[model samples]
Target: MADLSSNAPPNQIWVAVKKQKVWIASGILLLLVAALSPDQARDSLGFVAQSLLTTAPYLLLSIGIAAWAVATGADNLIARAFTGSPVLMIFLAALAGGLSPFCSCGVIPLIAALLTMGVPLSAVMAFWLASPVMDPSMFLLTSGVLGFEFAIAKTLAAIGLGVAGGFIVMALAGSHILHDALRDGVGNGGCGAAKIRNPKTVVWRFWNHGDRVEKFGKEAFKTTLFLAQWLTLAFLLESLMLAYVPAETITSVLGGTGIGPIAIATVVGVPAYLNGYAALPLISGLMEQGMAQGAGLAFLVAGGVTSLPAAIAVWALVKPRVFTLYIAISLGGAFMIGLAYQGWTLI
Candidate 1:
């Protein structure tokens, strides 16, 4: 009566997948068009090259900001002052988050630091919710691609998400909502949080520390590489969409100011959004194809908040309830903002 399943392989096999997703995707895309003539293949390569070129400026900008943020330890320093009234702390954290140059991945260490330092969960929630949406670098790039007004609106929306998420988390304090947030090794200085030191001293004597220089070099390279991979994927996908997806089809579904289109955009954004930098060019193309402004904005917000990488980072640090609430606030805020923007356009 030996059970056959006892000697079977473990159901969850941990596969060590390489990080060459862009290369793999590009290879598959080329294979899909392998039947094309040489000239068509050349044209397809040209499209991808052009897409890279189009995103080059933003890529450079993002690299610079990411490098500076890491070197200065500015984000962690900002979170050190989160000991005030709940409302004020939330506002400060959210504001600092909106201004920070870190992406969702970059913000994880800072969030861990705040939680470990006993900063209110509400304030940390605000920063965690807000930091991914916009930063100075993103603002400039968005302005260049989507227009100044759109950039401004999106920045405001980022801050708004922080404030709203802060208040809601604060209101739900003392319930099961805030329980068991700091999981094992999450906030106990495990996420590579920065040490607090005087900024002026660090900046003035920056070259004296060989260790920091080495760390900075590694961080700079890592940040740049990450951006290149995601952006390449984004550019390739956008090129395909432009070449294949009909403009009328996009416009027909996403071009309206009605609640239907807004809701659809929000839902689609959760899974479809790539990165804030990549979303710009895609959003630009969608707008050219007659996407409504409100819908486009909704998509950006939803995607930023619910991006797969970002969500995974948050999930690593908090319990299931807190993670679900994060998503709910992001979706609700995105939808409400879209509706409000659409209403304002009529005024």
Candidate 2:
């Protein structure tokens, strides 16, 4: 047999490597970690493996749903469902987002699907801004750790933050200030408007058509690969973050009153986020250490919405403009919500 493994041209090989950049970066980081400290490397890799295992079921479901939408042509229905009543849709999205089951990192699939399906960015923004903050289980956990009042306040904060952010996007869109939401090569899309111009009739029984079945398989595989690569990198970075950053360092800076501390908390929350389950106890401990109530709320809201992992996933899905607006809304609303909550506590 002729050894013809290097068949691809150099440029094509470079393009392929660029596409796999996240995986390459992940490998490099791991190698560096292993070289520097084998124990830390082992711990971080273990964390990534465990996180992936925990997230597997949700990832599979998301992939299946995404693939199903494409195969069955049900994406049009999804668009109509979300865009039927724009104002109502935004409100409902915010409300539903509070009860969403997805975690900060897991919400990316739906966000991408909604954008790809041409769902109005306003409603999607509402859902997008809110989904990461609080779920029913998180509410319970926050209640147990921080107290029922604080949990209720956080839940309300999630809904309110989303509603406000949605309307802001809607207003910007009205002024033509908002840019095209999705990125290139995301999904049957360049911009959502162009794709939804000629909506296809959804065939619920898509399996009856061989082409549809093939489409489903391809979509599923592509989605699975895309999500897996990004998710692995997200988890790997998250693992490193948790291992290196100390809780005391985070709490120390956030433990003071006024807008100054709240402002600092919002900024710090992005890099310092320890995930919902771990952060509650940490925040609770910080409160006992004199962390301002406002700072705590700001930290929680900011971290939940724009944590390193969640931000990375969002960056992968949307254009830079949309991502910037998303971060702006998160940071601004988190601070305001914190101020409002602080006022409420004073009263």
Candidate 3:
């Protein structure tokens, strides 16, 4: 009775529009194509629709696993990665981080919890570095877009980068340079800390618990929306690029098998990278255009670890010097891995 509509948050329709902006943008692009070139528009629609259906299985599997981790409270089990010897901890942390399906935003609170609890920086570094690069979903999607061999290679790269970063921090532990790395005034992950500090028993039978079942539904919906929005935008862009961008241009700029293209790809990746899922189809397109295999791999690795959001998160938690070290390791490791992968391709 008190003009309740006036005080209500922006119209639900508008709120939804904002949330689904990427899809909207994609829709607009299709409309323009329909106006300018009706034939191509039909082909584009077919390509996008068919591509989505083809990848549907992979997306469903990834979403289920990710939601299961959340609903079962298995995400809180990251503490297990730190329980062994320093060297062993590094290995497990790296491997677990690579396999875990935690999103960038979700990983933040957990990392805060880990550092505040005095988890050794070496192992923490390992976990942090690897977590962004690969996860079960990423592996499946990459396999769908790229190939099994490349997906397998990227998984190894994630673990390898994590191990190298961890050991480097371990060696530097004596200097105490990175000691107490967190910036002042950061909350100890707030409510998120409790889950890590005292992990709850994971109920794999999440359907039995009303709360967990609800959580799974919400998480699955969220993940599905996230993947669909980004993938739709990606496939849209892919259609346009294939329609307009010349193979000669992509080939001349990014083609060839050598250190040069790989290095260039790594550098460009820092800026041009879309989110992990969105990047796959674009890289696949470039490869079809003669982009070097090593370059593609380097771009994926570099982008995964050094994207702006990832960098900002690391910078916020640690001192500038520690941030610098993270960047150095990420870039250097990406380059070296690219070279190694290039050599392997030749063999």
Candidate 4:
């Protein structure tokens, strides 16, 4: 007989012994126990509902914006426009990213496309940091959920950090590093190699290429599939955090004198993943339970900046050192902003 242990796919092997069914049964039993145990079930249910509420709007916005970018090829155009000065390019890229509706995951592919199209690394880095925080959808969500003041503060902070970080990276690393990092893939001979195709012709070809609705449907499906896997994992993690981690735990750990809250919040947030929309309810809960504003803001920024999917995408494109610098700049910038916001609030 074949070596069934080695040959069997994990899923198949698990199912062969009914382990999958057993696991599901055990999970249901535990859920039932949790439900019957105390008020924890009710709290967990409330948390889950709140989490969904906070996340849904941002999720919709991300999908819509991603679809729009793919359909119109606006992402490429913006990246192409930023090829002049690395510093200026970074600012423009960050600005564009801030305005666009792509989430951290969507931003990664878009930035990759931009870099592949010859956009500077500084610009790409700026976009990576800015897009999640500055996008219109996220801004609107923040305003609706967190109020106008916080929304404005978040937007300004995102833009400031993006610009400052980009400039710092450019200054420290120099333009040559960006050029060299991009040399192998983003050189002149790559995507930009095609002679300037006529704009009108391109438009006509796109319109004429297959059934427009069908083409759009296909693209949307592909994009959704790509996002669903990552987003689902993020959502699952969010649920786990809500279910198990008490608000008081976070407050107790992070809530303290002077920028300590900000530091703790930022640290907690670095590993967490959630759309700003999804995070609002959690933040509100934390705030209600004594989490400081600055700390909350820190969490928001950290989550936005250090998403797993975005980091993976960046790693694929740039050198490890460059990627590390991007993360460091983003985290430090977020920490400073969070601290400033908290300080201003106290003053």
| Number of the top-ranking candidate, with TM-score as the measure | 3
Write down the TM-score of every candidate: 0.84, 0.60, 0.92, 0.69
lDDT of 4 by residue, 1-347 (tens): 22248878876776655623433543564487476755665555455456556656665665565555545544444444365677678877777767754434444445556666655566767777876666765676576556779888888888887888777866766554454564245333333233212111123234454564455566667555544443333334344555667878866876654677888788888776455555665575567566888888888888887767656766776776777787888789889999889888888
Report the number of the highest-lDDT candidate.
3
Candidate 2 collision pairs = none
- lDDT by residue for model 1 over 1-347, one digit each (tens)? 22235454443221212455566776777767656545555666787688668757766776776776667655455644476798899888788777766545556666676677677888888887777788887887787778888888888888889999999988988888787777677745444354422222335344467866666687778877776766666666666677778999998999877898889999999878877877877888888887888998999999998997778878978888889999999999999988888888767
Residue 26 C-alpha lDDT in model 4? 34
Count clashing residue pairs per candidate.
Answer: 0, 0, 0, 3
- Ranked by lDDT, the better of candidates 2 and 4 is 2
lDDT to native, each model:
0.76, 0.75, 0.86, 0.64
Query: Which RMSD values do the candidates have, in order?
Result: 6.4, 7.8, 2.9, 6.5
Local distance difference test, candidate 1: 0.76
lDDT of 2 by residue, 140-172 (tens): 667765788998999999999989998998888
Clashes of 2: 0
Q: Flag the better candidate by TM-score, 3 or 4.
A: 3
Stretches of candidate 1 exceeding 4 Å from the true structure: 1-17, 34-41, 103-106, 179-187, 191-217
Q: Lowest summed-lDDT stretch of 10 residues in model 2?
A: 188-197
Which residue ranges in model 2 land beyond 4 Å of their true spot? Answer: 1-83, 103-106, 174-177, 188-256
